[model samples]
Target: MISYEEVQKHVSADDCWVIIKGRVYDVTNFIALHPGGRQAILSHAGKEVTELFSMLHPSDALENLPPEACLGLVDPNTVPAQENVLTESDLQRRAAREIMPPAQSMMLLRDFEEWAQRVLSETAWAYYRSASDEEHTFMENQDAFRRYFFRPRVLVRDMSTGSTETTFMGIETSMPVFISPAAMAKLGHPLGEVNLTRAAGDWDIVQAISSNASCSVDEIFEASSEDQPLIFQLYLNKDRSQSETLIRKVEKLGARAIMFTVDTSWDSKRTLDSRAKAPTSADASSATVATLPVNRAISGYQDRNLTWDDIAFIRKNTKLPIIVKGIQSLEDVEMCVSHGVEGVVISNHGGRQADYAPAPIDILYEIRALRPELFEKTEIMIDGGIRCGADVVKAIALGAKAVGLGRPFLYANGTHGEEGVRRVMEILHEEITNTMRNIGANTIEQLKPEMVGPAGPWVGANRPPYIKQ
Candidate 1:
């Protein structure tokens, strides 16, 4: 039996897969008959293979060669070979009994060292969780979670249906949960973003595609259902044209909304990212995250140097409603309303940016006041530190139309890939249903701020350098 540790640990240079640039390469354990023409295992032997090419020479070199057979890893680009198409048997093997992995939840949520050790390859988890400047807000985000002391409510009925189902923007979805556009999924699974799309569709939920997604917009869309509501998250880049081009592609593909991510301006400083080394593959694309542009200016100018005016420009380019993420100020909220940008997703970019920024919930009241014209037209959402059903209920009661889940779903992706996400979704669903029944609230609208209050510290409090919305 392959332990989860063994699976992740064993994926080394020797334990490799055949891949091709700009083409699909499927290694579904159909080792008996590879569509790539060569004996399956023979295909992905060495790195930097090239020029004079034949499978046998390399295969024999690996098989019958002397004791020190490893002649160093070959560079993939140098390998001048044609890509092999995946056959039905390849699909069958791919569908065949896959190696089961261990539990998804890392010890990190509870233990810092264990979490760090678990997600060694996927560094973003560690980087995003770190603290910034004085780390006041960092401490506050965690402390906020503790404040919500889980008060067990006695129910009158035994048949309580906990619903993770909720809506985002104007569309109804299975749960408030959506795939949080995590970039470079292939880093975790061979199928990459392709695998994630399957989970989203099967579960009947929305997908908030990452600005720096590993798979191309076209590729991910091809893998997902035609009717699956897609929201394209944008990182305002230094190169405005590239962002504009990407946004247009999403609009053409029928994305329901544009989630303008004001959060990620630079590559987040993560301890794991700096440490983990990746084994290269052809089919494995980097999601072009580092090169892509994501910029944000606070002035609301949208100039040759982008400002909030760019929000209106984004709206003009596409028909989708724009939800401004990375908002912590009431001033930004009022401006979004004034600019006709549609909605606001109160977030601190999940603490990936400034470590000590305000928690989305901490500043919820100030921003909710902006949408006082009443709920229907202008919507409110938040992401960060949400772990349970009560967390979902608390956000709703505090005027969040819904919430966006990031880390938990990533945990889902890492633990069981598609199945893990489905499991986490079901757990959250039951938790939500449980929260509703316990609170005696039938509809989502019944949740009020008073029904929920800080079980912990709401950071970045006091006054700001701002105007009241």
Candidate 2:
């Protein structure tokens, strides 16, 4: 067995070593290959990373490491016990968690956000809440939803028989809403994407697994039932072979569809996430090490040079339906249909990629006006600033096959884990049912365009004269 002192000698970037789950690993070679960048590994080099690793990674994270990288297990008796020291922030979070209102009291999607804001760590909250630049698109996403008002047709049909069930790319889902792919769920809760998987199974809803999830795809798949329909959201790697390998693996593991995210070709400025401090280091020399923003650190491996031609590579690898997510314009939607993509998600990366990007709802409206026929050719879906069941109804009325919500579910899972996720689904189900009943629609297909319209005369009004200046 190696002593702890032996690991300390290899702390530099050129010769990094760390202990994980009581085993010594020479991670120098893996540093450059790490998806979270070299600093993410270098910051914790020469230390036992069981606690941190458990929080951010799956149990099998190190299984793929070359056998030669495993020097040996450390002497159990010589290694120091990890202390459960609580910082002031930890105490505050604990107090907030303790006083959290009962689950039954959560009446709306926004309730979970409040609870998460109270209980999550500062860094976790920052990462989930921050949008690109001034967050104009983030606010606009919600505002755009409000621009549409329901044209309720009362007493026209039996409202009590309404159902939210719908098919996504031929897969039946209990609701038209699917959990949008969000990265690093472990930052919100220990179980991470597993919580989402379990809840999705229980609620009979579709869960889109993120490429950058805290849990491994294997782990998330294991948590799901034999027939649970799951979608894999991909962030293509710079290495073509790696992406091909992943596509084949997910297909083999039973992913019903592949949603390739294209909007994040380049990282955007998220000031709030940048301002949050990186995890503190136990090493004394950490003062001299360079740190990266939370968003930039985790996204270093993304292929920024992605182009329309690359879609063929994904189509070549998997027989599953391919979805082009992050389409911001009607023209792009047309292109996706021309390329024979099965579906497209009109999204602005939840307003986290571009500051003034058009909201998904606005894009949906644009399609309705310019190229309504595209909806017939391809399955159109949308996500961004969705907080209620009415929002889902509005999008469906405007011709979206389904709708997606990212931050709401992240907040729900962060606050209460699997239970929180389930509650959010329950609330949305009730709201969607009520909204459908109110609008005189009994099925997902019954939501017609005439049932909804712009909020008022100012629906497409130009900016005020003072603001134009």
Say which candidate scores most in lDDT. 2
Q: Which residue ranges in model 1 land beyond 4 Å of their true spot?
A: 1-139, 148-164, 266-268, 275-304, 366-377, 456-469
Q: For residues 296-399, what per-residue lDDT tens digits would candidate 2 score against the true structure? A: 98898899999999899999999999999999999899899989999999999988998899989988987875678988999999999999999999999889
* Sequence-dependent TM-score of model 2: 0.94
lDDT of 1 by residue, 1-469 (tens): 2222222332333453333222122232333322122322443333223321231122122232233323233354444455657666545434432433343443222322233225423333333334344456655654675554333344534434434466768888876656665554544444556566777788887888876565567777888886988788886655578678878888999888998877554444432332332224643374322211111111112223557778877876788888887777667776777777777887776565677777777667554444444345478777777777777777787677777777666555554567656666666676777677777665665555555554443335422212232
Model 1, 467: alpha-carbon shift in Å? 25
Worst 10 residues of 2 by lDDT: 460-469
For TM-score, the strongest prediction is 2
Give residue 420's error in model 1 in angstroms: 0.9
| Backbone Cα, N, C clashes tallied per candidate | 22, 0
> Clashing pairs in model 2?
none
